[model samples]
Structures are given as structure tokens and as C-alpha cells.
Target: MKVSIDTDRCRGFGVCVSLCPEVFTLTDYGYSEVSVDEVPADLEGAVSEAIAACPEHAIETL
Candidate 1:
């Protein structure tokens, strides 16, 4: 699956980074930033958890 982050809606909570560090990182802006467009097979579960943990609902799976 592909992961997308809506920066406008992000609150820089770091939930995504905590849940899926392999797929996401905190930018200098303090919001979570995507490292890759598509998630690797091994990281899918973590990514899903990250999406669920996002309080701002900024992450979307496509």
C-alpha cells in the first residue's frame, strides 16, 4: 500500500514516527514526513498502526 501524509492537517505529534520509524521521520517542521511512497512488505503492519495512531487523521493509505 501507498502512504500519504496531509501536511496541512498534521500536528507534528510523531505518532507515525513512533509506530513506523522505517517508513516515516520527523521533519524540521516537526511534523511526520514520509520516507517512501510505498511501504515495504515488512513494514505494512507498522504503517497501519501509524495510520491508526494519527490523532490528526493526516495519514491515508492508498
Candidate 2:
């Protein structure tokens, strides 16, 4: 699975980062960003949780 973060919608809540550090991270400017090119099999569940937990609904699957 692939995921991308919508910077404009992200509020830097850090929910995604906390749920899955392997796939998501907070940028220097304090925003969520996708750290991986593709979601690993083992991390897909965590990534999905992050997507659901994100208040801004910034994470998207591709």
C-alpha cells in the first residue's frame, strides 16, 4: 500500500507519527509527512490506524 499526506489539511497533531513512526513523521515545520515511499506489509495496520486517527484526515492511500 502507498500513502501520502495532505500538508494543507494536516494540523501537525502528531497522531500519525505516534501511531506509526515507520511510515509517518512530523516535519521540521511541525506537520505530518509520509516518511516511506510505500507502506510495508507489517506496518500497514499501523498506517491504517494513523489514517483513522488523524483528526484532519490528511493521510491518503494511493
Off by over 4 Å in 1: none
Looking at candidate 2, what is the lDDT of residue 13? 86
What is each predicted model's overall lDDT from 0 to 1? 0.90, 0.92
Best by lDDT: 2
How close to the true structure is residue 15 of candidate 2, measured as C-alpha lDDT? 92
- Please provide, for model 1 over 1-62, each residue's C-alpha lDDT reduced to its tens digit, 9 standing for 90 to 100: 99889989999989899888999999998988899978999999899888888999999887
Which tens-of-lDDT digit does each residue in 1-62 have in candidate 2? 99998888999989999999988888899998888898989999999999899999899999
Model 2 misplacement above 4 A: none
Evaluate residue 5 in candidate 1 and report its C-alpha lDDT on the 0 to 100 scale.
Answer: 91
Error of 1 at 60 (Å): 0.8
